[model samples]
Target: MMEHSVIFPDHRKVCALGQGTWKMGKSALREADEIDALRAGIELGMSVVDTAEMYGNEEMVGAAIRGLRDRVFLVTKVLPGNASRTGTKAACERSLNRLKTDYVDLFLLHWGGPHPIEDTVASMIELQQEGKIKAWGVSNMDVPEMERFYAVPGGVSCAANQILYNLAHRGVEYDLLPWCRERHLPVMAYSPADEGRLSRNPVLMEIAQKHEATPVQIALAWILRCPGMIAIPKAGSVTHVQENYRSLSIRLTAEDVDLLDGAFPPPVRKVHLDSW
Candidate 1:
């Protein structure tokens, strides 16, 4: 099995595997199951919960971690549209009210937007000072954007960078991942399994058979193998969540890594970061 935790530049630690709530709380019929799935994942030590105001599910997350908040390392995001200094503060208040928590462990700018990065960075610093958030970061930032982010005041305090990374999308591995690693910033990978597409790959299937695991688990294990990388995969049911948790126990041999790398070649040149 691989290591289970990643440390930020400032030395904060979080689970390598986390729960993603991209389209959560969108269906009343599946709400109970989704909440149960998140709780089950938390019980299994995947306590880094990732959601956002954009996902429209902070209230559901609030309900799932209701009595168990202290056990969670909660993470959420502010929409890019509301990333101005004042807008950021207003967004945090709304997120806090929806999450039913006094403070979010980490808050992120959903993505680069019209607002100046300096303004958002200033706002994030202020929020930390007020104890409204423990730390702040960004999502969907490529290397150029990240460089620009670092150029601004207070940008060095960015704790992590969340991105779309998986076996299928290794473009970030070329430059973005290394750039963050150089700065000691952890990367929180959203859609790490490519929304289950990797589950059908014949190569992953062959490898999973050798390990007596599912192809999706192999995909997740590949992501977990990297240092300073975190994967947040959405599981809408308890069984799915348990399957994802089991990936942490998988140990892919060197040959297995080679086979996966051969099947899904890493990028040799920088490419645009994929966001969904």
Candidate 2:
């Protein structure tokens, strides 16, 4: 099996193919299936589990990792509306309660909020000091926003930047990706499959046939091609998560790369960072 992992600035290593719970926890009917899928991923070497309070699924994640917490690299986020110095801490506590864990391996600011970055940074640092979170990061930030974030005191301590990145969403490749790479900050690619849009592409299907893999796997493998990057695709069923885990073994050749590049052309000028 091919193992892929991302090392945070703080040197904490997690699986490059993490489990995403963005749309998980909404339906009670799929609760057992969701939990089983998460556990199955862990069993297959995907130990990084990303969740958020806004997803309203922390409790579900909590249940999934029960008695298996130490085996997982857990991450959750603080909502931007609750990103104040005091509100950040309060929000984290609520997340912890929902997660049933004392501390998250990583905590993130969901996005740029009304609160000052300085205040959020201070609160994040305080949370680290209090052992509520091991590290902090941001999500949905573009290059300019990242620059502003780094400008704040204590902001440089950010461990990673989670963004909307995938084969179809290559806008970040224009500048944001290089910017993060220059600083050696890991970029977590969410919605890596583009919500299954890439699964039916004729070009991708050709590449998948060559590799004997699914188009979705080829798409994900394309994102994993870069160093200092992680791809989080939500899989709500055992079979789906198994297929995602299998994507790790795919090694796209240079020809495959050229083919994909020609199909989903990389960004030319500086395009605005895309988000959901």
Candidate 3:
């Protein structure tokens, strides 16, 4: 198997920086601009580019990684509503066609839905066995659901867990993080800046001033500091991509980390899907 730097424990790589393709398919974004942003991200050392079949941005991502396919660690999710073995398998094939690749570095179940999780997980494993994907994981899953999924045969090998983790929403800190630590499952944080909230927070701004760094950089760096954590903040422009990359350079001191951790602790949110 090809070795990847982004892989965390259990042979998963830290998907260094990635471009989320949600906006690429928007009617407002001109094709040229979308392509430009993707090219910029690749040039800037963001090897992982995340997309989803539901996003309708797979074609754009496929175009972006055309010549650079070998270097990029492509990841995409299958929507939960489409979870049957046949549906899932067909979706993966469609994604492969749209992505212009035979296999993806990681394929994730977008969310836990009504379908039998075990059935979908089994299909995912079959894909891996067939060399259609290198690894598999789940997104937007909580500690209990994650545990349940892991309990399924051939499921404990889940490589990563993508969640909405950021400075403002650190609820995962209480249980998810520790659970992942025990299983060696890397946590892939999406919206690490809380949709630009942390990027402009007053407290974060003050901390950034002390370090002479941008608040967004501080937030992303903080996420990266978490054990077995990786982040995939979206970049809509080249400037934003450059700015996000700068986060990798800012090293938070022990005191700085403590202050930030105490200042903005995890929020209490309705995390249980059972309630939803």
Candidate 4:
């Protein structure tokens, strides 16, 4: 198996793949499936769980990771509108309550909003000091927006930048990914399969056939191959979760990557950050 880990600036070696609970709470009928799939991911060594207060599924994630709290690296996001010092603090508390955890391993700003980044980062810092979050970061921030945050006091400490990244959306590679690399900040790819849309791509299908895996697995393995990057691909069932977990073993060669490049070429120009 091709085992991999994303070593963050803090020296934490987290699993490259994680569980994303974005739409896992869509219906109460599937809560059992959601919970089992999440726990199954952890059991399969995909121990990073990324959820968001805005996702409205923290409780389900909480239930999923119930007895396995100590084994999971928990992450959750606060909405951008709640980026204020007070709002950020309150939102994190609410998330913690929902997650049934005392502290979140990572707390993120879902995206840039009307609130000031400095104030928001400051609030995040305070939260860190308060032991509410192990680390803090932003989501969907382009290089320019990140530069603005870097100007703030203690902004250089931002741990990770979660963004829309996948085979289809390689825009971040133009600048943001490299910029984050220069700063030693890990970039987390949310919706690494383009929210499952990449599964139908013939190019990926060809590559998947070479590896005897699904197109989604090939796309995810590609994301995991990047330096200082991690991907959280949501799985609605245990089978899907296992498939994602197995993607770590699907090694892509230079030829494979080149082939993918032809289909989903790297971005040469700056593309605005695509947020949910």
Candidate 5:
């Protein structure tokens, strides 16, 4: 639904609305359905697909986006445990193979694991040189931690930061969001619907009534309304993905925002990051 693009340091345009794939491969019972959901979303213009080695579903994602690889902006992560200079390269190679692609549009450090940020970042740089990943970033970061992340040599090249952010969990607004804003770095908000916990809010329901849309749309609209944001809500069915895609066209008015703000107020003080 987003016509404009968020340019990475390498000058590639990143789509704003995406599909998150967490707990996607943890079960085999629904593999085909999950792949259908992904392919459906991509067909509907939600081309950015975010996954991680930690999610255990790169193979499924690779299958779903098989023929549509170039149309989608693929993102995957290496676990912190695998962040060593050698480990990062190896892990990325494995991910690339599993993804059935030569390279990923964006690659990330899944979290702040035991590895030194320098070693991990250096490895990411190497992978970029070898064209394994076009750009790299970190996930689940706080403002202070991200500051320390960039302080490392070549750390300033981080293209984006993925974190748990949603209407119900607005903790990043207190600091992290503004930090990325100043630097023009896109903040990829995983679990943008609070893992599907936001659709039942009474206020969201009331607003949805006014817009003639579902509460899910109102919840996602709030996140996309913000500047420099990319919201990825996972879908396991084609219907769900289509619903998310339709949210892109739901533009909230100032009054709609004010009412929702009072119901689910923004954080005035810092709160801890909420994760899956």
Candidate 6:
């Protein structure tokens, strides 16, 4: 497994395996099984976990990481509609309570709609001051929106930006990725496998065959090659988690990277209309 400290500007070292808790619920993985999966992830050196109040899995995550809280970098998000400073503060406290923790390592603005972005960001800053959250950022934000946040007085550093980026969905490459790179902000890629689409791509298959690795590894390896980039892939089972961890060892050549890039071009038009 890949074991390395991913340092943010604030000098925090986060684990790269970042367990995604979107599927951690009785309906999804069963409460007991979810806890087992989380424990296994930590044993395998995964220290960062991504979750949200909207996911209904906070309690499960809290229960799983109860004793290991300090060793994990817990991140969660707030819904955009709850932009009122009071509402945001209440949400943070509720999340802390649900997670059975004193504070989250990072709190993200889930999106930039339903309320003025400024209102929500300002609230996030206030939460930081009160020590409810250590750092704050935005998810699904575009270039202009990110720039606006960066310009705010006392605006926290854009520690990380979460978005859908993979070999198949390289739309962010046209602008967002480069912008973050220039600003020294890490791009946390969700769906780095293209929702499993890249696992079946013929070009990736050929590359995987060359290295005796799975296509998923090749895709993740490509993402790791970029500076200021990390991927959070959800693994519901031990086998899937192991597969994702092995991605760190599959080194790709410069030629391989070029081939994969050519094989999977960025989308020419917007595919998903619904807001993430």
Off by over 4 Å in 2: 1-3
List residue ranges in candidate 5 displaced over 4 A.
none
lDDT of 1 by residue, 1-276 (tens): 226898766576777999999988999999999999999988888889999998899999999999889888899999999999899999999999999999999999999999999999999999999999999999999999999989999899999899999999999988899899998888999998899899999999999999999999999999998888899999999999999999998989999999998999999987889998
Query: What C-alpha lDDT does candidate 3 achieve relative to the native structure?
Result: 0.79
lDDT of each residue in 1-276, candidate 3, tens digit only = 011135554464544556666656676547667777778877777777888998898988888788988778789999998878777888899999999899998899998887888888888999999999888899989988898997888878788888887877777777777888887787778887887878768778888998898999899888876656767888777788888877777778988877886788654653432211
lDDT per model vs. reference: 0.92, 0.91, 0.79, 0.90, 0.87, 0.78
What lDDT, from 0 to 1, does candidate 2 have? 0.91
Off by over 4 Å in 3: 1-6, 9-15, 267-276
- Per-candidate clashes come to 0, 0, 7, 0, 0, 0
- Evaluate model 1: give its TM-score: 0.98
lDDT of 2 at 184: 97
Instruction: Report the candidate with higher lDDT, 1 versus 5.
Output: 1
Quote the positional error of residue 254 for candidate 4 in Å: 1.6
Model 4 weakest lDDT span, ten residues long: 1-10
Model 4: per-residue lDDT, tens digit, 208-270?
998999999999999988878889999989999989988898889999999999999998898
lDDT for 266 in candidate 1 is 91
All candidates: CA RMSD (Å): 1.1, 0.9, 3.2, 1.2, 1.3, 2.5
Looking at model 3, residue 182 earns an lDDT score of 82
TM-score of 2: 0.98
TM-score sort, best first: 2, 1, 4, 5, 6, 3
Cα lDDT for residue 63, candidate 6:
88
Task: Assess the local accuracy of residue 242 in candidate 5 as a C-alpha lDDT between 0 and 100.
Answer: 84
Give the better candidate number (3 or 4) by TM-score: 4
Candidate 3's displacement at residue 13, Å, is 3.6
- 4 or 5, greater by TM-score: 4
Best by lDDT: 1
lDDT of 6 by residue, 1-276 (tens): 444346677887666556777656856436676677777787777888889998888988898898888778888998877756677888889899999999998898887767666677778888888888998888888887887887776554668888877877777777777788887787678777877878888999999999999998888888866767768787777777788788877778988988876887665654441234
